[model samples]
Target: MKRGIMLLVVATILWGGNYICGRYLAPALPSNLLNTVRWAISSLLLFGLLSMNHKRLPLFSQWKKFALLGFVGIFAFSTLTYLGLRSISAAQAGMISAGIPIAILLFTPLILKERVKAKAWTGAFLSIIGVVILIRGEHAANGHSSIVGEIEIVLSCIAWGIYTVLGKRFGKTMDPLTMTAGAAVYGTLFSALSCIGTVRLNMIHMTPLAWLSVLYVSTFASVGAYLAWNTGVKIVGAGRAAPYINLLPVWTVIFGILLLRETVSILSVGGGAVTILGAVLASL
Candidate 1:
């Protein structure tokens, strides 16, 4: 259980770092193209691993579930996230994304018919309040912050919540490796289609550093972190596993201060602390 918790922390930091990578790499590689290449690499690597193990992939009966997972988990989540980053800072995106646990908690009773305790309700409410403060900070920091961008972030969180709920339904029946492989394959295709009009093949003129960012994100952040997260959640149970993701906002704040030299206001720290505390409580 401790190992799973540690792995979850590692996954959250890596995944949060992807936001920094996306912010830096997005201008060089368009959002759709970045997403396309990330998923393409994931698909290739996972497929190669499957071949090496002589494991037969998912059958036709499971294709539909994989397709839904790909659409919601990868396509919708990645596309909207990249688009949101175009307008928001990586730190702000991470902080706002702290709302995902709240989304999952709210969706629990409605979608999963799970019982929620009074303490959990209080935690969810506090988390929502923290999110609102973070959103206000975004506006105060950037005069041009748009409501549309905030909505996109919220929708992306919702997409993930839907994926989590759906995963509970299908994940028991499907192998995690096969499910991830299938999602990557379908997501790569969907991303490729989405990029046709937005990014050109000839537009890949990124610097070596940018290329490094892309490679790091594609390999470790997208593939390795995801596999670790799934395994960790299984070992520790979802409720215990979910709160570790709140670490991403904290990591993002650290990255922003060290890498971008951005100011970390008391509001940011206090809000993040309250938000993470609320998330931990809500997940109980």
Candidate 2:
């Protein structure tokens, strides 16, 4: 249990760092190309780990399923995140992402035929209110937020929610590592294809810091965090593991201040707190 808790904490921290990395790379790299490189590297590493663990590769017959997962979870979510980060601060991005659980809850009733409780509904309401507060706070603090960026981030969250629902529907028999590895392979393919006409050779000429950010996102944020999260979920069950996600924005805020030297507004903090509370309530 303790080990699981530690792993979850580590996963959240790494994911928080991902927002920082994404923001750092957004200006230097094309979002689509960067996502392609990130997932391509991640897929190779995950494939190597899958082989080392003696896990079966995804079957040819399962291409459609994995492709769907890859498209939504990896391709859409990641690409949109990078595009959004180009305009929004990492702290704002993280706070917006904190509403993903609410998005998932909204999807569950339609996808899984699960009953939505009143508490969850209330939580969703609070999440919306929190987002409004966050947006207003950003505006009040000198128009720091972009409407397009916020829309992209929200869409990314929705895509992720759908991916989670679909994963639950299709991946009941597969282990987490197998599922992640399979999805990543197809996701990398999609990301690479998206970059075909636009990818430039000069784009590969990254500075040391950009290269480091790429390495961190591809390795620790993508593969390592996924492994830790899946293992932690297995040990502690999804319900218990879910709440640890609330720590994501908190960590992102911390990392943004320390690493990115980004300023966070007080109202943004309040909004994040409200969002976290709503997510907690929804999960219960």
Candidate 3:
């Protein structure tokens, strides 16, 4: 349980870093194309890494599991997030993510039949309130977009919750490294098919910084964070592990302010503390 909690916290922190890298690339690259390149690179790297260690691939039946995992977890989550980010304000996205932990908490019991305690529910509630307060001071500043973007972000959140529950189910049958890599393989295929009209390889030109961002996302975000998240879920079940997601925004703010020249407010600091406390209570 302790190890699982630690791994989840680590995964959420890495995911926060992922946001920064992807955000840097957002203006320059189309969302679909960005999904394709990052997943393609991560998939190849994972395959090579597994081959070096003679790691076994999933069986034929298990391929379906991985593919489904890829579809919702990788393809759906990534595509929808980028699509929404294209139009949604950062503040809005941040607020929306506050629901993910609670959604996963509610869905886990229904989808995976996992038992959840009252304490967990309370913790999720507190964390959500913390999230609302955390981003309260940060204004939209300015924005203009249709409701389509809002719908996309909401779907992305639902997809993410499903991914976490499903990942735990898959982890019961296989090691997480193999699960992560397999999902990447299928995600690469899915994203490639989706990129036909969206991503233009002929016009590709990446500067050193852009390339660095890609490397960070493909390696750390795709391979490392996913492996940790899957393993953690397997260890603790989706119910206990879900609250760690609250850490994503906190980590994003910390990393963003430190590396990307973003700002944080005093209220946000209190929110981070409450968020962590809530997570701690839920996991206990």
| TM-scores, all models, native as reference | 0.92, 0.93, 0.82
Model 2 C-alpha lDDT per residue in residues 1-284, reported as the tens digit of each score: 99989998999899999999998898679998898889899989988998899887864778888888899988999999999999998999898888888877888889878888999889989988888788788878857569899889889988877776666666567777887888888888888899989878776557889999999999999999877876776677554666787788889888988988998788977887898899888879
Between which residue pairs do clashes occur in model 1? none
**Candidate 1, number of clashes:** 0
Per-residue alpha-carbon lDDT of candidate 1 for residues 1-284, written as tens digits (9 for 90 to 100): 88888888888889888888877886787778888888998888989878887877774667888888888888888778877877777777787778778777777777667888999889989988887776776667667876677777779888877766666556667656777788888878888898767777677769988989889888888788877777676677666766777887888877877886666456655676677788888888
- Itemize residue pairs with steric clashes in candidate 3: none
**What is candidate 3's lDDT per residue for 1-284, written digit by digit as tens?**
89989999999888887777766776767777778888889888888878998997864668888898889888999888777766644434544565677667767888888788999889878876765565453333223443576567668878898888888876777788788888887887888898787666654657788888888888898888998898888888776776678777667666667777765556656665665567556656
What residue runs in model 3 are displaced by over 4 Å at the alpha carbon? 87-96, 115-153, 201-205, 264-284
How does each model score on lDDT?
0.78, 0.84, 0.75
**Weakest 10 consecutive residues, lDDT, candidate 3?**
137-146
Candidate 2: clashing pairs of residues? none
- Shift in Å, residue 277, candidate 2: 1.1
Q: What CA RMSD would you report for each candidate? A: 2.0, 1.8, 3.4
Q: Which of the predicted structures, 1 or 3, would earn the higher lDDT when compared with the native?
A: 1
Which candidate ranks first by TM-score, i.e. highest? 2
